[model samples]
Target: MSPPHAVIAGAGIGGLCSALCLARAGWRVSLYEKAKILEESGAGLQLSPNACAVLRKLGVLERLTPFALAPQAIRIRRARDGATLALMPLNDAEARWGAPYLVVHRADLQRALLDAVAHEGRISLQTDAAVTGFAYGSDGVAVAISRGASRLEATGDCLIGADGLRSFVRQKLSPDDLNFSGRTAWRAVVEADRVPAAMRSEETTLWLGRKAHLVHYPLRQGTIINVVAIVDEDFQPDTDNFWSSHGASKFLEARFSRWDKSARDLLSAAPEWRKWPLADRAPAARLVSGRVALLGDAAHPMLPFLAQGAAQAIEDAGVLAEVLARGQDVEASFRAYQEIRLPRVTRVQKESRRQAVIYHLGGPAAFLRDAAMRALGGETMLARYDWLYRVRESPGQK
Candidate 1:
């Protein structure tokens, strides 16, 4: 008998990782990417120990290490005075969580996953292929693929929708609204020569303020720093355009005018800036429906506050692959994967939302929040997330 086959939609971190996991589990995998050319966007991502372990298990960690930055700590401070509040130690993260924390450019990680997928014989990848919809038949699940003006069909024992936030596959499964929080985020990367020596430390730094927060961390071995500034504001999205070249400097200049010179200088040094509204969906009790199921952003689009958006998706891929390897009915496998995953992702989503609130506390609330953070100290703060980082998974079963 032939090995079971799986069809994956989208080729982002989650999709590519899912394809690799399924193929490694003795399943023939077909991955469909909507983009004609898979270019790495200029953005950086944080890989906590939990996500790094999964990547290591999939055999992509070594390829990623060359581009990864292992920060020693995360420094939390006040945006106005730049006074250090607490330092979350990350140097010993590997010893504690069983894998090291890493930061890398989004493109580098994608390249590594794409390279691994290319070498795997069981996985066939198709670019310019968008999964429009899917249907379940007696033999298997049939998926509609749209390529330019033509539409084609592909069949597999099961279909996995790893497509990102604006997934067409998700809309087909159920109408889950992407709620835009009254907040907007600005992101930019500044080269090492442009940043001051003090700001380019081998640690992640966060500046908290009134109704806004700033986070910057080293990338490319400190040659560049990825900066993100998020502020609470009302926005009406064009619905057509998810991102635009807005005047990030102007917006940040006025909002963070009162912040310390260090923060202002970093903002000014960025050559260019881009803006996007933060959005998330309400947690759904059921992430699986029949032979078609969801994974990654399509399944749970959480806020970036927790830095677990990608990590949760990577975890989803690992669990989904393991569950499917059980040799159960296709529908049962998907249901099992969802049952094991939904609770954890939902909790992370809630925590991410809560962090957004805490990071942007105003006036008296902000003061008390800082006081609590200082009193709790960095080690305790990191300990609070032990449940998240200590998760261990094996391919045998859930």
Candidate 2:
């Protein structure tokens, strides 16, 4: 008998990782993307041990290590005064979580997943093939792909929407829309040499300020530093695109005007910057419908405060493959997938938003946040996330 087939939309980390896991599980897979060509762009992302375990299981960790950096610690500070609030030791995070926490360039992770997918005989990947919709029946699913003016379709046992925040598959599954959060972020990467000595440490640092926060970490083997500065503000898009490069340097400079000099220097060093208005949806009561299911940003988009956006998606991929490889009824497998994922991602989503509020606290609240951090201690703060990092398995997974 032939192996079951799985069709996946979106070639981002979530989609690619899911494709790799499923192909390894003896499923014939087809991966689709809307981009014309895969390029090394976008800011860095942190891979806590939870996601690292999945990558190691998928056998891509070795390939990724060359392009990734393992931070020694996570440092939290007051952005205005530059005073230390807490210092969380991460060197021992591996021993605790069973895998090391890694910070990697988004492009590097994508490249690693793409390379692994290429070697797998069970997976076929296509570029510029946008997933328009899918129709499911008793036997399987027929997924529609729009390539330029041509429309093509492929059949599979089930469809997985690893597509991002604006998922076409998600719209078909539910009539919900992603609501924009009243905040904007500036993401940029600069060479290590261009950054100040204080900012070049191999530790991820979070600088908390009034109504804003700054996060920076070493990437690409410490040759580059990824900086993300977010502030509470309103954005009115004149165009349909939620992301655009039309930000003024002066505006960014003014927003962080009261931050520490080191951070401001780093911001000035970034020759170019792009602005993204954060958007998320309230956790859906259902993430699966019959033979279809949503994964990653499509299922639960959250603020970047917790840095588990990609990690949760990678986790989804692993659990999805483990459940479906059982060869149970396809619809039941999808339902099982959602049942295991919804609660976990929902908690992360809520925590991420809560952290955003804490990070952007003002005046007396900001002072209290710092005092509380100092009292809680960095180790304790780090330990608090044990639920997120120390994960061996989810429901229905061995």
Candidate 3:
């Protein structure tokens, strides 16, 4: 009997990782990317040990190491005075989680995934092919794709939408329920050499202030530093129209000007900046519909406070591949995928929302929050995150 064929939409991290996993599991996988050319254009991303372990299992970790930085700690501070509130040690991350935490340029990670997908002979990646629509039935799932004036259709035993938050496949599945999270995020990368020597450190630093917070970490072996500033605001300009959009540095500086000198210096050095209006959907009543299923941001889009957006998506790929490769019934495998992923992703989503509030507290509330952090101590704060960093795919499952 022939291995089942899988069709994947959107060739971002999730989609490409899905293709890598499925193809390695002996399934014939085809990935469609709407962009004319494959280019990794994001600022940077942090991959906790949990994410690293999954990628290691998929044989892409070693190739990505050159582009990654393994920070020794994560420090949260008061934005007004740069006083440390909580410091979580990450030096022993690999020993605890079975893989090292990684900070890499977003483009570098994408390149690694794309490279692995290309090397997997069972995977067919079609760039410039945009998935226009999909139809599912008991027999199978069929997808319509377009590239300029030409259009094509393909059929597979199952379909996975890893198309991200604005997924067309998701629109087909649940059109009316998408909800915005009432937040906006600004991101930029500054060369580490440009930052003052005293400010350059091998640690992830976070500054929590009223109505906004900033996170910074070294990527590319300290050659560059990635900064993400998130603010809770009344109005967020719609950035959903374009996948990559540039934002004004002056605007970002004005918003964060009152922050500590270190943060202001870092922001001032940023050469490019982009804005993303954060949004999400409630956990779907069901992530699977007939032969069609959703994965990654399409299935769950969460706030980045927890930094689990990509990690959860990577986890979804690993679990889904294992279930399908075991030769289980297709419907059962789809059901298992949803069952295993929904609860965890939902919890992460809610926790991320909660963190947003804690990070943006003001005056008396902010003092209380910091006092609690000090009382808990850095070790305790690190302990609180064990549940997040320790999750891994069951070894005996496959």
Candidate 4:
């Protein structure tokens, strides 16, 4: 008879995309975000063809193109000599996957998704509402949230946790299972005009050295460059829990002092920088618990080496929405969602860890690794990722 109502926690990319997909499937959706104002906070995010396809299906791809860049190639170079170790071409990537690879500001993508959600009549967004507790029973699920001094409650057939790494919903499920990856990532955006003309390029460049790596790409129609430098360190700063904590330029420069000129130049060009301590959790044996389901980073948090953090989250939203639209038993649909997604996300998590080791090889080991990568060539890398980039969930099925 009536469409089921869904309550989504967090308005990040995953949550917003989930809301969009559920609303399109004729489900009434309400999204709660703790932030009073929705603004862009992070640096750049690279969307593979899989993520791009989902956005295209959601009708926001065209709107995002102006603020995004589709690089023709990705080059991995040695930090000492800038010698290319491997090159993956993206010239015909769109022809193969039906969508091109894209890089965009985290804020711009969020804005585009939010705008699309605004047009959906079945979806209502409530900002400044922080979900405090939830209860699942035979009748339904009831969520308690707070905004300032006021408390609000909502009941729905299902509750999805699309919140980020520090998800409140996750705390309820597996409170003591969180694990840290022992790596810290520093990110910043520098204006193209401020960078030296010789340093700017249309390609995505990565410089790998011992225990650290730097990735740089163009964003905002090539007007700004996004740089992410990750280092393996034993300690993290004791400060606020925010991901966008300001970082010191001197500390970063010292970390990369032995790197090549290209990385040095890029690091010097950074106008603003923030630090993010990469963290993850062992795969939850189950993503759904009765009337509640976990989505995005809350369900599966992976390292950024593979650049699939957001991409996987977007995939989760699509698959979950498709299963829920079947009108089958909610528990059965959610169980199917976890079964279909767990294996893939687990593989990604493991691969990302392997890449971290590969990118940080040192001395003779680094040279040997580079030689092996060159022998395999660019086509091999692209071929290796086809399974990840080509996946699509069939609607109305697990």
| CA deviation > 4 Å runs, candidate 3 | 239-244, 393-398
**Model 4 stretches with alpha carbons more than 4 Å out:** 237-242, 393-398
* Candidate 4, residue 366: lDDT: 88
| Alpha-carbon lDDT of model 3 | 0.85
TM-score of 3: 0.96
Overall lDDT per candidate, in order of appearance: 0.88, 0.88, 0.85, 0.85
Judged by lDDT, which candidate is best? 1
lDDT of 3 by residue, 1-398 (tens): 87789999989888988899899889999899999887765677889887888899888998899888888899989999899998889999988767898888888898889788878999999999999988888778889999889999999999999998888888888884556567778888888889998667999998999999999998877888888888876664555563346878888778888888988999999888887777766767778887788889898888899998999889888888988888877788888888777777788888987887888899999989999999998898988878888846582332
State TM-scores per candidate: 0.97, 0.97, 0.96, 0.96
| TM-score, predicted candidate 2 vs. hidden true structure | 0.97
Cα RMSD, each candidate: 1.4, 1.4, 1.9, 1.8
Q: If candidate 2 were superposed on the true structure by all CA atoms, what would the RMSD be?
A: 1.4
Per-residue lDDT over 257-298 for candidate 1, one digit per residue giving the tens place of the 0 to 100 score: 999999999999999888888887888677888888788889
